[model samples]
Target chain A: MSTIEDVTREFEQIIPSDTAAGQSVQERIIQMLEELRFEDRDVFGIRLAMEEALVNAIKHGNQMDPTKTVRIACQIGQQRVRIEIEDQGSGFHPEDLPDPTADENLERPCGRGIMLMRAFMTSITFNPTGNCVVMTKDRSEPEPETPAGESA
Target chain B: MSQGNRRLDLEEVNGVTVARFTDKKILDESNIQIIGNQLFSLVDDDHRQKVVLDFTNVEYLSSAALGKLITMDKKVKAAGAKLRLCSIRSDIKEVFKITRLDKLFNIFDNRDKALEGF
Candidate 1:
């Protein structure tokens, strides 16, 4: 995995607080990920995580305020892909979030995005303001060898 | 929500409502609202049970979409119906497993297997 010191390429963009704009930003990031030759599975997970973060930034963080903007920064390296997303809103503590996995919370729909981000990425952290999220996926592990009887 | 702006292709088979969303990337909030309304309406308004969401074409899902699924599942359960998911790719299935939603809802490898229990 590439350490923070070994960033090969970096890009950043500020998207409007519109869902359409968010999709465009995600597509641009996906293009970069493809150029990096990330594994299919990794690309899928990264895309989902990026969407979750971007959605949270646009909806929950900016509250769909057209005047607000979502800032996204990407760092692509030989061994890792890192992204940071920030929104302009009153930040909320990530620790205060309800456990979506808990039986009592399972039925609620909105709390699972953060959990999904954590699940897909190798590392996830929220800024003190709670308005920014940084996530990374490491490519350190070798692809699992397909079993003899199974086709990949 | 309206007939003109349908985002999902819903099919009724053997009393099971199979909702197939075609967007390869379901990352936006607009998509979430559409999917949430479509899935929840199946239970709350249409009163149809045994809903199956086929993800054969969906390559990715945002967290907001995941939340909508949870809401849809709860609505189905409250209506005394079952919601099953099928054809989720292995890469995306990891999200369900990580959130422990694989335990909360019935997931099948394909639509036929998902329809079996319903």
Candidate 2:
């Protein structure tokens, strides 16, 4: 298996606060993941996480202002990938986000993006102002099933 | 509707409306808005009593897409109609689970199962 030392490819781009531009950036990262032989499930998670983060930056962070822009940086290794996304806007506190999983909020249309990002990424952190987010995902192998009698 | 404007392939199966998403990725805001409108029209305009969302063709969906589904659910309930989802990819299913939306929506393994009592 490859290690962090195998990290090679990197990408950096500044795009308008438009989802089309965000999608292009996502495709480049996903293409790199595929080239590195990342597992399909891992690719799925990473793609989903990137989608959430980019949308948050483009739509929520920049409020889809054409004048605003989003900066994305990515580093891909054989074993892991890291991404940083920063938007031009007044940041909000990540901690203030309502728990989408909570009973009262489950049916709400928004507020689930951050939760999905945390679930799919190995690690996710936000800058103090919360306009910038950094997320990392280490390629993972699926866990083996517990034996019938030994199930926890 | 023009091909570009139609996001769902609607089929009526035994009085139930089976709406299949045509896009492989439902991520963009404009696309989600169009989809949400088409979906809402099922209840608001067409008055579908039983609706089944077939996701077999959807390989990717963003939180905005999920938001549309939640709003659709609300509309269905408001109209006293039924709503169910089927054929979601496993990874996408995990998205629902993480959001605890699996508990809120009636999800099935396939269209047959999703349509079973409806």
Candidate 3:
């Protein structure tokens, strides 16, 4: 695995408060990850986490205000790859989010961001401003032990 | 979405309705919501049991789109139908792999391979 010191790449992009903007940010993130020598898996998680972050920022934070801005910053370091997404809106507390896996809300379309973030990233945190999210994914780890003939 | 070409192709088999979406990478909540509606209208109870989504032209996908898939799957399964996929490209496959969605959905190498058991 290439350590952060081996290749530390950075990316910064600002997109309009629109869905298409999210795609551009995702593409930029993948390009930056590639420059850091990350393959598909790393890029996938980062893209997923970052997309959720941006969506929440645009939809929830800024309330889809076209005039507002969503800022994204990424840094690849030795320990992990970190991404921060900030919105100009009043932020919501990460702790306050309801669980999407709950039976009562299983059918809901919205509320899965936190779940996916936790499931895919090493850590998902929020800043005090309530409008910023910091998500991290550790460098790839060895595969989990799988019994012979057992599918992971 | 652009109507630039075909993003989805519709088929009905054994009373199941299938709409294969291709080359879709950056779909949002609005378009996905619309697709959801279109999917509901396309698949009737008679054809719900054997629907397939072909990703032959798709190379990448977003988690939001994945959310849409799960929601769609639930609806299809409720109607006693199944939603399966085939011909998923490698780049998009990695998204499914990393997100552990590979285990959540039935994926095949090609359209014929996916529709074989059904």
Candidate 4:
């Protein structure tokens, strides 16, 4: 059986604080996941979580400053994918964010991105300074095989 | 609107306006801004009483897109107009569910259902 270190592929890059730049990085990571034959559902969740995290890094953390940069590190394996995103700006407290799901905040336009990142990722963490976030998603188990005669 | 500039395909069905999203991935900020403006115009400019946002062609969207939808819903409600969302893929639907937006907006499985009672 392959361990995390045995099967994992590691990558790292630093990108400009531009949405387009972030998108290119996202596309690269997605292609890697597809190449590994990750399930569609897992891919979908990871893609969503990554988008939110990168947007937060580029737009919110770095404040879209052209001079600032976002660093991304990723590890992809047969059993899981892990990503770490860090920005140049000072981080804010995650607890201070208003709950988008609350009745009073439902109509609010923002604040849902972080919630979504947590929901889609199997595990999510923010550095104490709040400038970086790390997320991971475990590969879903395949559906059990049925007997040849069963309709299923 | 210029053909290339259009982000939604608007059709009037029995006095209800159905606007289908043209893009498959509504993730980018500029694109979401354009879509939001078009959606708000349905009420602010056209003054349409009943609107349905059809998502059959949309396969992926981000929180920025959701923010636009929330703003659209507010405009629709403030104008005393009604808005409904339909044909959202399961993955996208889960996003709404996670944000508790499924309860905020009137959602249906298809356009026909969304247009009902309009």
Shift of residue A150 alpha carbon in model 1, Å: 4.3
Screening candidate 2 with a backbone cut-off below 3 angstroms (N, C-alpha, C), the clashing residue pairs are: none
Instruction: Point out where model 1 deviates above 4 Å.
Output: A1-3, A140-150, B1-3
Q: Interface Cα RMSD per model, in Å?
A: 1.4, 0.7, 3.8, 0.6
Best by TM-score: 4
Candidate 1 pairs with clashing backbones: none
Tens-digit lDDT track of model 2 for A1-152: 12245668987899999999998999999898888888878888899999999998988899999999999988888778889999998998989988888899988899988888899989899989999989989988856667899843
Q: Model 2: residues >4 Å from true position, as ranges? A: A1-4, A142-152
Q: Where's the lowest-lDDT run of ten residues in candidate 2 chain B?
A: B1-10
Q: After aligning candidate 1 to the native by TM-score, how far in Å is the CA of A9 from where it should be?
A: 2.6
DockQ, all candidates in order: 0.77, 0.79, 0.26, 0.84
In model 4, the clashing pairs are none
- Tens digit per residue, CA lDDT, model 2, B29-54: 88899989999999998999999999
RMSD of 2: 4.1
Interface RMSD of 4: 0.6
- Residue A10 of model 2: what lDDT? 88
Which DockQ-derived CAPRI band holds candidate 3?
acceptable
Which structure is stronger by DockQ: 1 or 4? 4
Give the Å shift of residue B17 in candidate 3: 3.6
Chain B, TM-score, each prediction?
A: 0.93, 0.96, 0.79, 0.96
Clashing pairs in 3: A4-A77, A4-A78, A91-A130, B15-B47, B16-B47, B48-B81, B49-B81
DockQ, 0 to 1 scale, candidate 1: 0.77
| TM-score of decoy 1 | 0.88
* TM-score-better candidate, 2 vs 3: 2
